[model samples]
Target chain A: MSQKMTRRRLLLGGAATAAVAMVKSSFGKMVQTGIPEAAMDPTRQVGPLPGVLGTRSPFEHPQRKASLTSSQTPLQDLYGIITPSDLHFERHHAGVPAIDPNTYELTIHGMVDRPTVFSLADLKRFPAVSRICFIECSGNFRKPDKETITPQDICGLTSQSEWTGVMLSTIFREVGVDPKATWFLAEGSDAAVMTRSIPVSKGWDDAMIVYAQNGEAIRPQQGYPARLLLPGWEGNTSIKWLRRIELSDGPFMTREETSKYTEPIKDGKIRQFSFTMDARSIITYPAYPVQLQKGWVEIRGIAWSGRGKITGVEISTNAGKSWQAARLQEPVMDKAHTCFRYLWQWDGDTTEIMSRAIDETGYIQPSLKELITARGIGTGYHLNPVTAWLIKRGGEVVYRPEKWK
Target chain B: MPYWACVAGIAMISCERRVNTAPTHFGYGRPATKQEIAAKAIAIRPDGKGLPAGSGTVQHGAVIYAGKCASCHGVTGTEGPFNVLVAPDTADAVPFDRAPQRIKAIGNYWPYATTVFDYVRRAMPFNAPGSLSDNEVYSLTAYLLYANKLIDSSTVMNAKTLPGVIMPARKYYVTDNRNGGDGPYE
Candidate 1:
């Protein structure tokens, strides 16, 4: 790895190179006008050196806003679906545990004919699989705040990663799960000893025991050594620092399931174990804190769902009154973020623009009013209302606030 | 000669191409092992499989509750500035839109008795969690059940007997079936 050049250093180098070029080009009108002199000065540069550890570009910096319990992602600065491993959102109860990979173990016991304990090495030795999926917190929405708040602040508790791990069914087969068992309790090794009861059907499906993210060992903030990966499910269900899985006949109804994850619906009935996230989208560029131009502008954003593919994403320039389908970037994936773009002819008028996601299930993303009317104001979790960006005639963009009551 | 020098400089600049080489070494450690995995598998399931061996009566549980839990949860587990732990079985009553002005106790909302034991043992007592012994937890579970009128005051709870008691809120709880198609549920 080479020493990353900071913006200040690059600017200084550019100035010195310009002075040298000026001296060299006295007779002719400096033939090389656009190209920087640094491109011509070979002797001034150093060769590639090895042995340097991982690092980010000194000129660029993306960071998370850390508080007592959770950290918000910087969604405004990101350009793609894959979040850098370091910038992934975090929400841990009782703080992250420092587990030595050598000492870490995953035990599969209870209601199984063959109880088994898998060392970290044992899990890696099995057939490994990798898939890209998003893990979003059950409580990921916020009230309309100041214009400085990015999409990350609005719903940054969600993130996507190319997770590499053994299929959970491989471990389940090794343990020989009992046929009668319907649910399994997944417990974490954190200080709070976080735990949730997941259905057995999920274990046999797309669930994974992931150990790596983004082509490297998982970041400590994203469950260092190993974590459960329930594709497209609520983030809480994917327990980090995973240590135990016990098969059983019924749900554990843990504190998280009964008191926390459960959301109240239209009637008096509370929606418990509401796991999968509905389809949703957000405009990345020309959003809050980004100024727009008057003429033709290209709008880019991401759309995704837990149910299936994002078949279509509709953009509304007049606060969802008129809808036009945005061009879906090719190779749209299931339970993974799909990039979408729209070429809009901006007339420089003050207008509210928003995007609504329609998944393969044909379920249209609800507006804030529709969501409140359906779920009621008392419930705060699972809030996925379509987000609106208010673009001013002066080329400034701001978030449009939606009142609950 | 100057033209040749300019061509050589362009060649050197173009040669600075980024390589797609495989990472020969990693900065982080390797994966976790089976023995390490076994040291922490303490979760209990609904089928009474992972439950530890212990037994306690409603009478014994009442004493433990008074000594350890009554401060925050209130006497008899009814009053609370926090969550309520006991109530009469009202499976048929409509749930309040807001968390009721009165306490919506565990008997009214909790769907499984196994959860009551699993939760109390894992995180409870407000200030301290994982402090109660298995026997003590079992006794408190029985006491709460008795108070909620689900079990008799004389009932004893253990690994076997604890899962057998039916919960009032069990019928209302349904598995998520939202992925298949469009409806109020899916």
Candidate 2:
């Protein structure tokens, strides 16, 4: 379906060129092709136009996957780490509620010296900060054999963006946080009225109250007016459509933290508040359903860690026995996706290839066996084990799934 | 000429004002009410502030456990092929890498006791969710606590008693103090 759409766009561009040629011949010397006639000219075409109401690209059209809960980005077609503003992955508990900007207000109360409510305009008046980071769902891992699955299916839940917003510390200062306040409750304005208890230290450390993503006002799906941004934490912690913040002495233990996000560990002990994502790597190119020729194969993939920067990534051609370091792309930012590549000569022998990430904290990517041994085999969330792809003699590549049991 | 120029400038200003008008207010619904807020604020804190008022004895919980929970969690809570919910308090002495031993129940790894009632009432029994009455949930909490030796077999568990039980693993769990300035850990 995507290939068909790309072909149609190319055909439209050709047709537009032919139409321009026809118009040029009809007008002859009286009408210039570069400049519009004075009678029909709207902006005079001499300087920048004053203003425009609506916009649509003459060449391209990109859309989101709409469903009951979440809409996904087109991951298979993206090139870089930063997802386009319109293509950011979206997950809302209730439907996207329409908010009137003038009436939108954020209240900060409870365990604060000065409880205050700030309007949307008031938030923008503060000094702004920008940072690039990736937000990923806790349940993003999926199996490979399903050919119907696009890159969206494998890991579309994760997307990177340059977010512009006010630092949460700035708001905390305005409200004057009480000394006893240890946790904060961030609530959204949606019908579900989603809420989560965030540690107060995170606000002082690196949290942001963002109103923009990828250089534009944030899209409605990515939290239009304003949202919380917790760099390197789980996506849900960055609450969307934010409305209220209440500081407290302890965690609120919301339904999300207790019944949902928490995963049972080995034995009967359930692990809660496990927010930071461990180091992980995945091969994007020459993956399932993409056939390769027996020649120089440029292995391309992405590596990231919520803890910090990705120190190194190693590729294994013969399962887990041997490994070779892959080249990292330039300007590898912290808490952001770093692209990696390896030039390999493929003789097309049946072999399995895999990639593993090592973060700055010296935490090595664990194998499936190691993961299962540590966390037990009951729960299925936050599975970031090294992924492998099997290449047949015929040059067809397939995903090699590791059995859970 | 000066008066004429002033009149022309005023006309231009009026023309610009006709093109745009700033809105004074936005039409949105009223703020959420206190009752609406209370209905959804069903979270059990570590200090047990939101715990419901009900009590259950271990003897009553044993009967309920044998009928409903015993199939999946085991009869005595130690015979689980699924998840073992109970463990001997002395089992913490065993090393993690040693030979396979009894399952590490809530007594060994959980940092807070309030989490047990909070989790079970929300998503337990594998099939039915939120089916257990408040008394039944309290009973189940009592049974699990008594089985793990955190409480006596004859003890009754309610809102007041459940939060007071100290978990053995509370001391081991530590806050993640990682920051980007000094790497991920201290």
Candidate 3:
């Protein structure tokens, strides 16, 4: 694999701390120091001893760009399905809260025969189930009509991880949920006390109260002690820092649901409770900020859907006139991000390239124009359009800007 | 039969415990008390199921809005550096789906009146959330509603009347229509 690697070495922790104290950047800033340029090649040198935790190479700074309410993951730098827990995109109504795992307790009440409180340890004692899935924010699409934008800047709110926990069905059984319950309110413990009314069917179907993410305790930013994980649904429904679950007969129209998540449809109506993310794909390579060479280039990207597994991904080399199927990387799990690639020999000619995901439900990823024709450009949520990149004959690549019509 | 054995592995769950038909409660947690549930039960439904018993008038709310909320929501509740709380022109008459600007606010977009109370009580004032009293939340809800012309100056916002104060935009809300198929994208 040809790595777009930055210049090297970052010394870290313990003995490196003292060594880092000696180094400064060109501007006289106290930058963490690595071995001198002479020692850059690792083949001849002995590495330092292992520490409590490992750190990424100092040169590799794959990070999330943070905003007031959300952060975008650096999609171009990632490999495979599982997103590094730290690099996972975050969307929170309130900032991450510090909660002690020992004191963490989840209260399940309302419309249940036996309202109960389970400590974190008590929860782990129940049957554990782990599954890999992608959690994409319904509002992951952002096309600002800029050609200089990277794939990370376009749609980086989606991320994947193998979450481990006890199923909500097991918890419901433990609490003896009432038969009349059709909906349940999931409440977070953050300052906003963020709440969402979820269908009871979702709980019985595939919901979980997850504590471990990608194998370890979930990071505080991703909800420390525990969170509610609803596979294939929008990220907002998976209430982080989950504190309470109240079963009810109808939906509780909270501010997030009514004022925020709802989208404007074709008519004068507002579409509420639109939870699933549509099938979408974007070619990371040969995309903006990544200049390309003429010969053999493999187009690579990720495709996922809330409905089911990604069945196929069609690649268009000449701006959507015709298409060919890309190779789907194996171990394609349900409702998870699946990688796709296609080999192409560029002839040093200026052209546009794009990819569209087709899910098991046979839902083909639509273009920005089609999305606007169907849902209108009024609502800024649930947009998953076929993204294209304009490859210049001079080996420069840029995003083909699509205006929100 | 070993219940733990059946629950240990997802692949090894063929044990009769999986077919208990009626699941045996694992008894992992203790019964929650009413106080425990009520302490964190702050969410208010559209039907006012969880609305607190306090009351506030538009006049009283204006005072609270000026002191605590005006810094972030603007003194008039319309010009916001963050989110505009009031927009009277874009009320029930405006078809948001086709509107030119599509500037949504509490009056034109929000469907539930109780949400004002619920949201303010949980997250408001910007500097310090969940710091508002029940009376203060009611006052702010009334003040914002009054500013949006959704309620009269004399109208009191409380448990009994909050739910009955039907929002104009409530009629336009519908459940999701997209069923993910070969059909057209809705």
Highest TM-score: give the candidate number.
3
Task: Please identify which of the two predictions, 1 or 3, would achieve the higher TM-score against the true structure.
Answer: 3
Listed for every candidate in order, the interface RMSD values in angstroms are 6.6, 8.0, 1.2
Q: What lDDT tens digits, residue by residue, belong to model 2 across residues A1-405? A: 644433222112221322111122453543213322234332222322222332332234555565556777766566768888767888877567788878887777778766667778878877789999988877666643453454566676788999999889888877778978999988787655667889999999899999998888888878879999998888888998888888889987665665456665554455667778777788877687788899899888888888889989999888778999999997688888888889998987988888988889787777777777776664555767787878889988877766764
**How do the predictions measure up, each by TM-score?**
0.75, 0.65, 0.92
**lDDT at residue A290 of model 1 (Cα atoms):** 86
Candidates 2 and 3 compared: the better one by TM-score is 3
Question: What does candidate 1's lDDT look like per residue over A174-203, in tens digits?
Answer: 667898999888988876678998999999
Q: Compute the interface RMSD for candidate 3.
A: 1.2
* Residue A74 error, candidate 2, Å: 3.3
- Model 1 stretches astray by more than 4 angstroms: A1-51, A143-148, B1-108, B124-129, B136-171, B180-186
lDDT of 3 at A152: 85
For model 2 the local lDDT of residue B85 reads 82
- Cand. 2 TM to true fold: 0.65
Docking class of 1: incorrect
Model 1 chain A weakest lDDT span, ten residues long: A6-15
lDDT of 3 by residue, A1-405 (tens): 112121222344442323221344599765544465444555444344333466665456787988988998888899888899998999998799999999998999999999999999999998899999999899898756788998888999999999999999999999989999999999999988889999999999999999999989999989899999999899999999998999999988999899999987777889999988888898988788988998999999999999899999999999899999999999798999999999999998999999999999989999988898998767878989999999998989999888766
